[model samples]
Target: MISLPEDQPRRISEGERDAGVRRLQEAYAEGHLSHEEMDGLLQQALTAATHGQLARALASLPAEDAGTTSAIGAVSGRILRRGVWRVPRVLKVESALGRVQLDLSRAVFEHPVVDIELHLGTGRAKITVPRDAVVDIEGLRAGWKDTLYRPRRGAGSGGPTIRISGAMGMGRLKVRHARR
Candidate 1:
C-alpha cells in the first residue's frame, strides 16, 4: 500500500482533486483559461498529492461565478451563516421581527467586492467580517431609533470590500470585525 504524508497539504483527498478539476473546467468554459491551460491544470489537479498543490492548480480560477442569494428570516426566528462556506457575489437579506447573522471571518468569498442589501423590519441583523476586510456602509438608511454600529477601521483599504446598503425601520444593524 502506498502511504501518503501526514502533513496538512498531503491530507488532500481525491474529492478535492475532482473539485479542482471541475473549477478549472469552469474557468476554461468561462474563457478565463485556454484549452491547453485547462488541460495542464486538470492534470496537475488530478495528480496533486497535497492540498497546496491542488490549490495552486486552481488558483487562477475565479473564486465565484456571478450569482446571488436571497436569505429571509421570519418572525421569531433566526437565520445564521457561518463556517467555511462559499459566499455569493450578491446577498439579499430580509429580516422581520427576527435575528439574522452572517459570519464571514472564515468564509471563502467568491468576489473581491460583495454587495449586501439588507431589509430589517423591527428586527436585528449582525454581520461579522474578517478584521482585514474593508467595509462600506454609506448606503445604509435607518429610521428613527434605528441604530448601526460599524467597525472602527475605515473603508477602501485592506482585503475584500463588503458594500452594505438598504433600510432599517425600527431595527438595528451592526457590522463588527471578528476577534482574531
Candidate 2:
C-alpha cells in the first residue's frame, strides 16, 4: 500500500453547494430518493463546509449525462412541436403573441431530468407530457390565468422529471398527461 501525506480539508464554495442541492433535487424528481431523503440531503448539502461533505451529500447519484440545451423563440405566429422529436435537457421557449404547443408523449427524453423555461407574452401554451412523467411547475409565474394542471395521484410510473419555470404574460398554461 502506498502511504499518502495528510492534507488539509478543502472548503467548498457556495456554488458547489448549490450544485449539490440541484443534484439532490434532480435525484428526488427522478424517484431515486424519497422526499424525506432528499430533504435530509438538501440540508446536509446546504450546511456542508468542506468538499468531502458536499460529495457525501451528492453520493450515489446517477452519473451526469452530457445533455444539450436549445432555445425556441417565436413572434406573432403558432409554434408547435409534435411528432417524434428529441427533447433537450434544458429548453428555453419565448413567444410573443403566439400560441405554443409541445406534445412530448412520443418524444425522446435523453435525460432523466428536463427543465423548460417559458417566457410568453399574450399567448396560450399547452404541454402534453407522458403519462409516467413527473412535472413540477411551482416555479412558473403566470400574469393572467391560473395554470390548468391536474396532479397525478399516487406515485409516478418512473419516467423523466420535467421542471417548468419562467414567466407568462397574459397567457394561460395547460398541462395534461397523455392518454393511451
Candidate 1 TM-score, true structure as reference: 0.59
> lDDT score of model 1?
0.75
Report, for every candidate in turn, its global Cα lDDT versus the true structure: 0.75, 0.86
Best by TM-score: 2
lDDT of 2 by residue, 1-180 (tens): 655555658786444555567778888889999888888889899999999998888887887775899999998899899999999999999999999999999999877678999999998999999887878898999998999999666425556778899999999999989884
lDDT of 2 at 50: 94
lDDT of 1 by residue, 1-180 (tens): 665665334455443455566677778888999889888888888888988888888888877566667555566588789988888878888877778889999998766668888888877788998776777787889884544666554433335778899988887888888776
Q: State every prediction's TM-score relative to the real structure.
A: 0.59, 0.67
Residue runs of model 1 more than 4 Å from their true location after superposition:
1-65, 150-158
Clashing pairs in 2: none
Candidate whose lDDT is highest: 2
The number of clashing residue pairs in model 2 is 0
